[model samples]
Target: MIDFNKEVDRLGTYCTQWDYVEDRFGKKNLLPFTISDMDLEYPDEVAQVLQQRLDHRVLGYSRWKHDDFRNSIKNWYSKRFNCNIDSEWIYYSPSVMYSISKLIEIFSKDGDGVLLNTPAYNAFYDVLRTNNRKVIKSPLKNENGHYSIDFEDFKEKCKESKLFILCNPHNPTGRVWTEEELIKMINICKEYDVKIISDDIHMDIVYGSRMTPILKVAEDYLDSIYICTSPSKSFNIPALTGSYVIIPEAKTRDRFENIVRYRDFVNSPAILSVLATMTCYNDCEYWIEELLNHLENNLKYTISYLEEYLPQLKLKMPQGCYFAWIDFSELNIPGEQFQKMLIDIGEVAIMNGHVYGEECEFYLRLNVACSRDKLIDGLDRLKKTIDYIKL
Candidate 1:
């Protein structure tokens, strides 16, 4: 039984969430409910595999195309989602973002419009901007706390866009896309000749919500679909730097391999990341199950806490991902002021929503993947910030 409440000290390890809060928040030692990485420990099996590889000490250029790597991923998808993944469809990348950026470059030209649902993963914005592509927004409708895509708007955007970037089990607002929702988006993109890039990095961690992998629904439309995902988010191993893309079309896969090998010169996988992936995918199923239960409890606590105390702050329990996207619009506080107050007055570091997109100005994304004790402290600080505002 994995102890999800175990508090692992990460402050001195050059950790981004704890040690480097000052970099983004401009303050040190602030309790951070920021950064997507978990405060929870990963499975011991991952560490054991990594240690076994480190004991060999060769550290040479490592290939990721072996049966061990491919079979582990294939079996995981089969067991977890009941989705069959072909070994040939899996190709390695250093990270999910890298694969998405490369696919954007491969499929679209500069100044070409890329359709994205607004209030997306903030990094998607960075990827589009850095690549010189036009960001065309099809904002999701927020009715009360529930979020759903506006297909009419999505269809209109797809007509003019060259590619559509999707965040399955979407970040900030964790709406796990239903099969019906995904099929609609896939068909719209197909009609417009728009290529699809589904970032399913947060595929795990779903709470009772079914995670319909875009590949599952895109059987006939495989040529236009690319699924970029990683075990990094699931296993808390982002530092290991391993991710992959699932491209069913042989010609498209070859084109992407050329970009990764020749253009990026990313010939070898990170040895430790490969080993960690294999171990976690093959051996850590129970760990994920336990983590999800913990997250669900944390999420329920968050929803109950807000309802009882800070009823003004609206939060809908997210269907997937361990993030609580709380609407601060009812507070009527300006986004900039609210963020500053959280940092300076409450001494807490929570992500302000405006960075995601212009539509999310009055929201905040809180990381709930922490020990329950730490989550309580963060919530208390948030309450303090609200109290100060009310006074």
Candidate 2:
């Protein structure tokens, strides 16, 4: 046993996931399992690399020489997924959300519809709506504890839609979509001429055997597929940032590059973050695998606890990510109330599923990336809260 719990207390000195977000809920203290950010410390090697970079001391403009960034990314992808990536496909910017918003502006004219599958990451809703763009949702099929995309609905949306935002290893639902699913999805987008901006930020955290980056599956059809990925999720360092978009064609790539240039957000990150990103990808495999194992075990423990103590609380163990989308619909309460009840009474602050989409009422998403003990404590608090409420 890796004792992932004490490690959190030891390392989470300034953890935003654990220490921050108190203000969001207006609480004096909070046990927040609401965030997607993990409470784990970086691997010692990554820490060492950053320290070494800092020792060099002058914070100045940094540029990538040769294939440093791409090579690190390529090596990580190959080792993790056996998927070969290229330096040519690499294009970067600071924000994936910013990049996605830019594409919404590019592909869709004013008031055009952009397709999203719900429940999705809460960020997408703001990203679409704040730009005065319209959001059209074709809800995921949630039958018998499994979530699947409604292909017909997706295709239908394509006729009226100009852009498709894909959350691979999807958030909230935690389905690490199969290649067959990705292939059919690609074909539908191709058939309907709906351009795809696939978000694979959770690409490296899958609980399953594989996660097919949309581009890796849609290789021949790459001109239409825009894949966004980052070391953020894998290394738990979104703040120290940059993300790359893989566009297969020169024209599509150039258009994005031009847009990024216009926005003035296109530039290589400083050595501090870029150096950590490079090292995290190139090294740190064992720690990542170990972390995944811990998360998988955490998910298993959560499921088992629910079955034994709270069987009415239903959730399928997600095939990817540490997010547990537990359906508390049987309680017949609004998801927000349930989340608040958990926080106010149970003292466990979790994300309300309603934030994901309209269909997610009466549900909550718990991030289980903390130590096993913290997860167990959260589950215990949840069990007591529900049991008391029911009584």
Candidate 3:
């Protein structure tokens, strides 16, 4: 039984989620429900294997070219998602964002348009802007709190862009894209000749509908699509810094590999990172199941707490991911003002949704992957501040 209740002190480990929040907000001792990583401990099996590898002390250069690493990924996809991934299609990278920036460079040129849904993962915006690619937003429609892709808008935008980046089990909103949704989007992208770069990092953390990988549903479009995934989010090993891309088409795979080699970016997977990922895929299913149960309880508690203590903040319960997308529009406060009040008076730090995109103002994305004590403390602070400010 994995203990989700244990509080881990991550204040001084250079943890961006906990240790750097004060620096980011310029407020010391602020309760952070912001960043995406969990406050949970690594799975015991992963931790043990990683430590064992570290003790070996053969810290020479390594590559993930072995069958053990490849088979772990293949079996994981088959067992978890029921998707068949060929070993040859898999290639390692230092991180998903690094792979994505490279994909953007290879597939599209500067000033050329790349598409995304609004209220996206914020770093995606950074990638596009840094690469000098034009961002074409195809905003998702919010109907009675559930989010749906505006298909017509997406189709129109596909006509204007040659590349589309999809975040399945989307960030901030946490709606797992259905197979039908995936099919429709794939069809539109296919008709318009748009290459898709699907980010499926959050697939393992799903709650409601099972996540359908674009690769599984759009086999015919493999030549123009690829998936960027990592065990970092699933296994809580971001510091290990390993990610991979699945490109089934040889020509595209060769082109991407060439760019990586040319840039001398053939980053060998860390010894601990490789062992951790292998452990996650091969030995940590039970731990992940327990984690899902804890996350479900956290979501329920958060929704009930908000309804009882702060009904003005409407929360759309997430179908997947640990984030809660909350609507504070009824409070009659601008998002920037609301965020500032939360930080100053409440001493709570959460992602101000406006940074996600223009349409996300008045929404706050709260990360709930923490100990129950910490969660309750943050909620209490949030409620106290909102009440105090209303008076």
Error of 3 at 46 (Å): 0.8
Candidate 1 lands at a TM-score of: 0.99
What are the Cα lDDT values of the candidates?
0.92, 0.82, 0.88
TM-score for each predicted model, relative to the true structure: 0.99, 0.95, 0.98
lDDT of 3 by residue, 140-184 (tens): 999868999999999999998979999988997998998889999
**Backbone clashes in model 3, listed as residue pairs:** none
Candidates ranked by lDDT: 1, 3, 2
Instruction: Say what the RMSD of model 2 is.
Output: 1.9
Candidate 2: where is the Cα deviation over 4 Å? 1-3, 10-15
User: What would you estimate as the lDDT of candidate 1?
Assistant: 0.92
lDDT of 1 by residue, 150-262 (tens): 99999999988999999988998999999999999988888889999999999997999569899988967888898999999988999999898999999999999998988
Deviation (Å) of 220 in candidate 3: 1.3
How well does model 2 score by local distance difference test?
0.82
